[model samples]
Structures are given as C-alpha cells and as structure tokens.
Target chain A: MKKLIIASTSTVHNSGYLEYILPRLTSFFEGVKTILFIPYARPGGISYDAYTAIASKGFETIGIQVSGIHEYNDAQEAIANAEGIFTGGGNTFELVNQLYKNNILESLSKAVLTGTLYLGTSAGSNICGVTMMNTNDMPIVYPPSFTTLGFIPFNINAHYLDPDPTSKHMGETRETRIKEYHVFNNTPVLGLREGSWLEVMGDTITLKGNLSARLFQPGKEAKELDSESVINL
Target chain B: MKKLIIASTSTVHNSGYLEYILPRLTSFFEGVKTILFIPYARPGGISYDAYTAIASKGFETIGIQVSGIHEYNDAQEAIANAEGIFTGGGNTFELVNQLYKNNILESLSKAVLTGTLYLGTSAGSNICGVTMMNTNDMPIVYPPSFTTLGFIPFNINAHYLDPDPTSKHMGETRETRIKEYHVFNNTPVLGLREGSWLEVMGDTITLKGNLSARLFQPGKEAKELDSESVINL
Candidate 1:
C-alpha cells in the first residue's frame, strides 16, 4: 500500500522548523528509525549538508535519524534502502533538475509506491502531483521535463494563499494563476493552504489540517474542501 | 541606437488601463504613426482580437493606430516594418512560446536594436531581459528556452513586489525567489516595481517613475536604485 504525507509547508507561523507537523510525522513514520532526506531543493540556496542538518534536527524529536541523499555515493541505492523518505522544499525547478540529472527519479517514485513511508513539504509536495506546472516557485533553473512522480492523480499548489482583498498589487493572484493553468491544462489542481496536508494511505486520501483547501477543476468553479474531507478528485 | 520603454505594468492601481503612462508613451513614440501589438500574452486568457482591441483603444489616445501581430499574414514582415512595437502583459510562457512558434523572436529583437520605437509591459518587458527566468508569471505552457532578447545586460523581474512584513504566509517572497535565481545564474536582475519603468536610449538605461527599483546582482546584497538613476548594469 502506498503511504505519504504531502504538506503545504514545513513550518507555520510562530513555530520552529517542522514544529507544527512533528506529531503527525511521528505517527506517520512509526517504526522507521531513519529517513533518507532529499535536500536538493536547497531553500535559499542552502548547502546540502546544512539543509540535511536542519531536517535532522526536526526528525530528532521523533527519535529518527536523518541522512541527506547527497551524502550517499549511490543515490539510487540510498532510495532503494531508505526506511523512510523526506523531500524538503525550495526551488522546484532546481529540485526536479537534480532529480533528472541524478537519474534517480524512477527509483524514488518506486520506493514511495511500494509502501515506503514518505513525507513532502512545499516543493517536495509539488512533485507528488502529475506535473510541476502548479508550483509557485520561480523557474530559477529549467528541468528536462515538467513531469513529476504522479504519486497523486491531481496537481498541488503548495503554500496556496487567497488574494488579499485590500491589497493593490497588480500581479496576478494565486487563484488567477491556477485559473490560467487550467486554460492550458485539464488536470485538477488542489490549492493546499499553509497548515494543511493530505494523508494518503493505500487508495484513500484525506485532508488532515484545520484549514480548508481549494479544489479547482477544469471548466468549473473553484470550491473549498473542508478539513478531514476525503479528496475524491 | 536602441529605443525602448520597458514598463512594470500597463495598469496601475486605481487607474484606467495605460492611463498613467499615456503621456510618456505619446512622447516616446513621437513621430511613429502606428504600432505593431503582440497580443500573445493574453491577460485573463482573453482572445487575441479582444486583447488587441484594448491595446488599440489605449494607443488611440496618443493618436497612433494599433494592429495585432496575429492579424498579419507574415509576423516577421509586420515586425520588420513596424514603426513602433508594443508587447502587452500576460503569461510569459505562452507569449514566448508563440514568439518562437511564429519565428519572430530574431526579427523583433533586430527591429528594436535598429532604432524602432518599442514598448513592453510586464511579461512583455520581461523578455527584453537576458532571460525569462526572472518573470513572475506561472508556467502555463513550456517554452523552448528561457533565453530572451537580451536587449539589456540584465534580467527584469516585472511587477516586483516587496515582502509583506505582517503576512503569515510561508511561501518564498519575491526577494527570496530572485536570490535563488542568482545561485544558478550570474545575470543581474532588476526588480521593477509597479509604476516604475526603464527608459532605454542608445546605450544608456535610466530608471523612470517616482518609485525606486530593486537591483539584485550575484554574490552581493540587493540594493535599491533611486528613481531617474542610470542603471549601469
């Protein structure tokens, strides 16, 4: 059975890194002793070792050791043997670029599909979708393809925010961007707000956070899915 | 001598479309009678004809005629013979995709380099840079390459916004996104805030409007370029 936790963000406001999701992660990774961290996203252009240390500190609270994929000489072997896997967030383009360059995209996808405990945050959660087209991250680097793992049937817009009613900025809002995506794509998109996550166990996927997530289907009005609701689409 | 007006946005808050910039545009296109409009970046997914009409209406105030590039049988000839060219704001990916598909990228670049008056707003202005990697638009469609006209030595981040200090959203800010770009690219980036613009005449590029634009150079702290200041980079 496939098992994964796709979160909008690792940290919420007024909290330390991964503090908000620690409890959920603990239960999700129950018997796993160590997690293989894919820190290629490199938020703020952080070094692999430094990003790994941060993930390690977060996993320590759950009594699990964390190791970065870059630390391994054989990345494919590392994913194949990982007890649990956690992909951190940063620039989605660079993350996907490195995955293709390393030629381990298939290995990682296989591990997740074969029931290995998996956790993804932000850009990490984005790849769980059919494509990286819905990502909000800047295209700092161009990937070979926009195709992602397809761990889920739909696409994810992480850290999804509603347009500020009072703001005067002329840039397109998050909702507007997603609507534009639908013009060129028919794939359904879920706007995963911060503090929200989707828990996938076997064939069932349930929203597990307090906030409601916005679901956008092609040629249809966007609707809000309440917390704990099963996401059928 | 290159002559171009790269604007941050066509419409500002609480203003009619192109209302604020009409006066400057009138003087910019002084003797030009008609402008070739590139409506590929259709805002709100509007049709090419409809978008062209809006541009036509706006240009009418300056006593200039407008014709969309799509209406022409040969886009290359239209650009080559254009007295002035205007590329409106919309999705950058789609705009660039159409540019390459129509095989007019080189022709348009050449026209601007040889002293034809040119104007660009938002996504349009983004292409005047070295690459479209710094644009804020969603990747609705994949373009062949991120490489752009390279009219200027640096990249332009159109509709550049400052980080909201009070927002609880955890997504990367505009500044953070630009910083990530510098990690993989040495190209300098100019964050053109709304209501701001760049006036390029000959080899000199000067910042216009009352607002200051943020300049991001690799391996250095981002600084603010005062209004009317010459952009040497």
Candidate 2:
C-alpha cells in the first residue's frame, strides 16, 4: 500500500521550517531511519546545501537522518535506496525542471508506488498530482513538460488562499483561477489551505489538519471539504 | 514608429469597462476608424463573441468600430490589414496557446512592429513583453512556448499587487515570485499596478497613469518608478 503526507506548506505562520508538521511527519515516516531530500525547488533562490540543511534540522528532531539528492552521485540510485522521500517546496517549475533534467522523475514515482514513505510540502505536494498545471508558483523556468508524478488522482493547489472579501485587486481570485483551469482541464483540484494536508493510505485519501479544503470540480460549483473527510475524487 | 497602450487592466475599481481609460484610448487611437479586437483571453470563461462585444461597446464610445479577429476566417490576414488592434485580458496561457495554435504569433508581432496602433490590457499587455513568463494567471493549458511578441524590451507583471503587510498568507508574495523569475532570467520586469500603464511611442516607454509602478531588475532591489517616469530599462 502507498503511504503519503502531502501538505499544503511545511511551515505555518510564526513557525520554523517544517516545525508545524514535524510531529505529524515523525508518525507518518515511522520505521524510517533516513530520508532522501529533494530540495530542487530552491525557495528565494536558496542554495541546495542551505535548503537541505533546513530539512536536515527538521528531520533530526524526529531522529531521522536526512540526505539531499544532490549529495549522491546517482539521483536515481538515491531514490531507489531511500527509506523515506521528502521533496521541499520552492518554485514548482524549477523543481519539475530539475526532476526531468536529473532523469529521476520515474524513479521517484516508482519508489513511492512500491511503498517507500513519501512526504511533500507545497511544490512537492504539487507534483504528487496528475499534473503541475494548477501550481500558483511563477514559471521561473520552462519545464520539459507540465506532467508530474501522478501519485494522486487530482491536482493540488498548495498554500491555497481564500479570496479576501475586502480586497480591491482586479486579478483573478484563486477560485477564478481554478475555474479557468477547469475550462481546459477536467481534473479536479483540491485547494489545500495552510495548516491542512491530505494523508494517503492505500486507495483512501483523507483530509488531515484543522482547516477545511476547497474542492473544485469541472462544470460545478466549488465546495468545501471538512477536515477528516475522505477525498473521493 | 510603434504606438502601444499596455495597460494593467481594462477596468478600474467602481468603473465601467474601459471607462477610466476611454479618454486616453480615444486620443491614442485617434483617426483610426476601426480596431481589430483579439478576445482570445476570454475572461470569466466568456465566449469570444461575448468578449468581443464588450470590447466593441467600449470602443464604440470612442467613435471606432470594433471587430473580433475570430470574425475573420484568416486571422493573419486580419492582423495584416488591421488599422488598430486590441487584445483584452483573460487567461494568459490560453491566450498564448491560441496564438501559437493559429500560427499568428509572428503575424501579431509583425503587425505591432509595422505600426498598427496596439492596445493590450492585462494578458494582452503581458504578451507585448519578451515573454509571458511573469503573468499572474493560471497555466490552464500548455503553450508551445513562453516566448511572446517581444514588442517591448522586458517582461510585464500586469495587475501588480503589493504585499499585504498585515496578512498571514503563507504563499509567496508578488515580489517574491518576480524575484524567483529573475533567478533564471535576466529580463527586467515592470509591475504595472491597476491604474498604471506603459505608453510606448517608438523607442521610448513612459509609465503613465497616477499610480507609481515597480521595476524589478535581476540582482537589484526592487524600486518604485514614479508616475510619468520614463522607463529606461
């Protein structure tokens, strides 16, 4: 059975990197002694070593050793041997680009399918979907394709924000953007709000955390899914 | 000489469609009897005919007749003979996708270069830049390339928003997204706020409207460009 923790964000407000989710991660990654970190997203243009260090510190609190994929000579071999896999969030385009360039996308997908514990935050969670088409990140670089790991049945809009009723900005709201996505794509989108996540076990996926996520389906009105609700598509 | 009014948005808060900029557009499109409208952006999932009708109504006030490029059997021929052209706001990915599918990217670039008065709002304005890499719209569909008209020297971030100081949203701010873009691209990006625009006449591009715009260059701190300031980059 596949096991995964796809979180909206690694950190909530007023928290350290991965601090808010560390406790949950410890349980999700139970029995895993080490985690192979994929830090290609490079948030704020951070270096790979620096980003890995943050992840390493977070995983250390749970007694798990962390190793960045870059530390290994063979990225594919690293995934093949990883007891657990964690991809950090940054720019999705950059992350997806590096995945294709390193030729580890297929390996990573296979590792997760064969029951290696998987954890993804933001951009990492985004790639767990059918496609990275719904990511809110800027297209800093063009990836070879928008295709992603397809571990999940639907796409995820991580760190999803609710439209502020008092805002005067004329840009499309998150709801509107998803609606536009539906016009071209039939894939359902889960708006994973901050502090929220989806826990996948075998064929069942359940919403975890306190917040209710917004679910958008094609040709239908968007609805909110309460915490602990089974995400049935 | 190229004449262009690249606006951040077609409408401002509490204003009718194009009401705020109609007067400037009247003079900008002076002596032009008819304008070819590209309604490919199709905001709100509106049909091309419906979107074009809105543009037609907006232009009717300026004594110029409007015809959607969709009405023409040959889009390239329509661009070749256009007295003036207007591309309205919608999903940037969809707009660029259609532009590529129709094989009209080169023709549109040619039309604007050869002095067909061009007006673009939001997504339309975004394409006037080197690439549509900086747009805030969702990537509903994959385009052949992020490359655009390249009528302007740099990229544009339309409907540019300022980070909310009091907000607790964890998603990357507009400034952060632009900074991420700079990490991979050296192209300068102009953050055109609603009520701000770029008035391009030949080689000179001046920031218009009452609001100051933000200019972001790679490897430098973002700075605000005052209204009416000439954008040298």
Candidate 3:
C-alpha cells in the first residue's frame, strides 16, 4: 500500500518552516527514523546541502533524521534504503530535471509505491501527479519529460491561488491556466491551496488540511472540493 | 533591419484589446496591409479561428487585416510572404509546441530577421527572447524545446509582477523565479511588466510604454529600466 502526504506548501504566513504541518507529519511518519531528502529543487538556487539542512531542521522536531539523497554514493540505493522519503519544495523544473538526470525517478517512484512512507511539499507535491504541467514554477530548466510519478491520477496545482478581484494584473488567472491546460491534456488537475494536502493510503486518496481544493476535469466545470473529501477524479 | 514590438501583454487593465498601444503599432507596422497571426498560444484554450477573430478585431482598428497562419495551406509560404506578423499571447508551451510541430520556427525567425514587421504580446513576445524559460504560463503541454527565436540577446519575463507584502501566499515571486532561472542559465532576463514593451529596430532595442521594466542579470542586482531607455544588455 502506498502512503503519502502531498502538501501544497511547507510554510504558511507568520510560521516557521514546516511549523503548520509538523503535528500531522509526526503521526503520518510514525515509526520512521530517518528520511531520504531529495533537495534537487533548490529554491532560489540554494545549494543542495543548504536546502537539506532546512529539511533536517523541520524533521528534527519530529525525531526523524533527514538525509539528502545527494549525500549518498548512489541515489537509487538511498531511496531503496530510506525508511521514509521527503522531497522538499523548490523549482519543479530543476527538480524534474535532476530527477531525470540522476535517473532516480523510477527508483523513487517504486520505493514510494511499495509503501515507503513519503512526504512532499510544493514542487515535491507537484511531482506526485500525472505530470509536472500544472507547476507554477518558471521553466528554469527543461526536464526530459513532463511525466511524473503519477502517484495521484490527477495533476496538482500547488500553491494554487484564486483570482484576486482587486488586482489590476493582466496575467491569466489560475483557473484560466488550468482550463487552457485541458485543451491539450485530458488529465484532471487539482488546485491545492496553501496548507492543503492530499493524503494517499492504499487505493484511496483524501483531501487533508483546512481549505477546499478546486478540481478541474476536462470539458467539465471546475468543482470545489471541501476538506476531507475523497478525490475520485 | 529587424522591426518588432514585443509587449508584456496585449490588453492592460481597463483597456480594450491592443488599445493600449495601437498608435505605436500603426507606426511600427506602417505600409503593411495584412498581418499573419499566430494564434497557437490560444489564451484560455480558444480555437484558432476564434483566437484569430480576436486578433482581427484588434488589428482592424489600425486598418490592417489579420490572417491566422492556420488559414494558409503552407505556413512556411505564409511566413515568407507576410508583410507583418503578430503572435498574440496565451500559453507559451503550446505556442512553441505548435511552432515546432508546424516546422515554422525557422521560417518565422527568418522572416522577422529580414525586416518583416512583427508584434508579439505575452506568449508571442516570449518567443522573441532566447528561450521560453521565463514565461509565467503553466506548462500545460510539453514543448519540443525551450529554445525560442533568439531575436533578442536575453529572455523576457512577460507580465512581470512585483512581490506583494500583504499576501500570505508562499509561491515564488516573479523575481525569485527569474533568479532561479539565472542559476541554471547565464542568459539575462528582463521582467517586462504589464503595459510595458520592448521595441527592436535593427541593432537598437528600446523599452517602450508607460512603466519601468526590471532587468535581472546573473550574479547582479535587479535594476529598474525606465521606459524609452535603450536595452543594450
């Protein structure tokens, strides 16, 4: 059975890193002593070591030691041996790029699917979907493919923001972008708002956290899913 | 001499489509009776014909007829004979995907390089840069390559927005995203805000329109370049 917590973000307003979700993580990752951290998505282009240190601090409070995959001699071995795996948020493009480059996508996916406990935030959560197409990150680097772990049947628009009616910005709204996505792709997309996450256990997927997630299916009206609802689409 | 108007967006707040810069377009596209419209970006997944109709209406005010490239049997020939070319914004990935699929990138680049009058808004303007790595649009589709026309020396972050201090959202800001891009690429990126544009006349590229554009070069501070300033870097 696959078990995962795909969060929309690692931090919320006025909170320390991973402060908002640590309580749930403690229970979700129970019995796991150490986690293999994939830090390739280095946010703002930080070094892998530095990014891993941040991840370590977040997991330290939960009594789980965090080890960056890069610290290992072989990344595939790291994933296979990790009691728990965590991919932190950063640049999805670079994360996907590095995953392809390192040839670890398969190992990482297999380990997680076989029931290795997993936690992903932002860019990390984006990869848990069918493709990385819904990522809001800039195309800082081109990955080999948009295909991802497909842990969830649908794609996830992490950190999804609703249209700000008061703003004068002319950019496409989050909904408009996802609708445009449906024109080329048939895959469903879930707009996961900040602090929201999808908890996957065995064959079931449930929306966790306080906010509602907006679900977008091809040629269908976007529906808002309240927290704790099962995401069938 | 190459002539192009690469704008951040076609429609600004409280303005009709292309109404923001029609006067300058009239001068830039002078003597052109008809313009080829590349509507592949198809904002909001609108059909090519539907998207073209929108472009036609915008260009009609300037006394120019708009013909979508899809209307022509031979897209290469259409580009070869076009008096003016306009690529409107939507989704950059799809736009580049179609351009490659149609094998029109070379022809389109050749036309623009040989002094064919050109206007690009949003997704269209994005291709005028070195790569589509800086676009804010969703990946929605996998483009053959991030490589673009390279009409200019650097990339353009169209519809660039400033950071909102009041917001609680944790998504990467436009500036942070571009900085991340710089880590992977040495190319300079101009954060072209809404209503701002870059005008290229032969070797001279000038910033046009109402506001200042932010420029991000690798390993340097982001500087604000006022409208009407020459863009040498």
- Go through the candidates in order and give the C-alpha RMSD of each one to the true structure: 0.8, 0.9, 0.9
Report, for every candidate in turn, its global Cα lDDT versus the true structure.
0.94, 0.93, 0.93
Q: What is the TM-score of each candidate against the true structure?
A: 0.99, 0.99, 0.99
lDDT of 2 by residue, B129-157 (tens): 99999999887788889999988899999
Docking class of 2: high
Better of 1 and 2 by DockQ: 1
**Chain B TM-score for all candidates, comma-separated:** 0.99, 0.99, 0.99
Residue-wise lDDT of candidate 1 within A106-186, one digit each (tens)?
Answer: 998899889888999999999999999999988899888889999999999999999999989999999999998898899
**Candidate 3, DockQ score (0 to 1):** 0.91
Those runs of model 1 whose alpha carbons end farther than 4 Å from true positions after fitting are none
Q: Count clashing residue pairs per candidate.
A: 0, 0, 0
Shift in Å, residue B15, candidate 1: 0.5
- Give a tens-digit lDDT track for model 3, residues A73-181: 9999999998999999999999999999999989988998899998999999999999999999999888999999999999999999999999899998999999988
